[model samples]
Target: MTKIADLRSQTVDQLSDELLKLKKEQFNLRFQAATGQMEKTHRVSEVRKDIARISTLLREKRAAS
Candidate 1:
């Protein structure tokens, strides 16, 4: 999970990269769940929240500029 402060310190490009990675992780988690091979089920929610946070931050940055 990423801290908001840490994310806030990063540039937009960096945040975009992080968001992409998290999205990929979320996809893998979903796949794992579907296959009944998921161990840490809580990670799905964490990754989702992280994605939301990054998206919100990105929107705020764009709107501010």
Candidate 2:
């Protein structure tokens, strides 16, 4: 797994793609949980944190411009 700093180093486009992917994964996790098929359910929280981290970095990067 990539570190938050490493993720921050990426370009906006890359970060956007990753953010989208994370959201999709989060959706799937919710579905799995609802169906009682989720393994490692704690992962959902981690994904949320990652999304927030990425978004915060993105905002910082933009504001620095």
Candidate 3:
């Protein structure tokens, strides 16, 4: 899990990369849940929150530019 402060220190490109990675993980988590193979269910929510955080930060950067 990534902290907002840690995310804030990253560049836009890095954030985008992280977002993409999280999205991929999110997709996998969904698949696992559907198959009843998910071990840590909390990961789904954590990934969702991280995705939101990264997107929010990206938007803030865009708006500030």
Best by TM-score: 1
CA lDDT of each candidate? Answer: 0.95, 0.89, 0.97
Candidate 1's C-alpha lDDT?
A: 0.95
Q: Report the C-alpha lDDT of model 3 over 1-65, residue by residue, as the tens digit.
A: 89999999999999999999999999999999999999999999999999999999999998898
lDDT of 2: 0.89
Candidate order by decreasing lDDT: 3, 1, 2
In candidate 2, stretches whose alpha carbon ends up further than 4 angstroms from where it belongs are none
Off by over 4 Å in 3: none
lDDT of 2 by residue, 1-65 (tens): 44987996799889989999999999999999999999998899999999999888889888898
TM-score of 3: 0.96
Better of 2 and 3 by TM-score: 3
Model 2, position 51, has a per-residue lDDT of: 91
Question: Which prediction has more favorable lDDT, 1 or 2?
Answer: 1
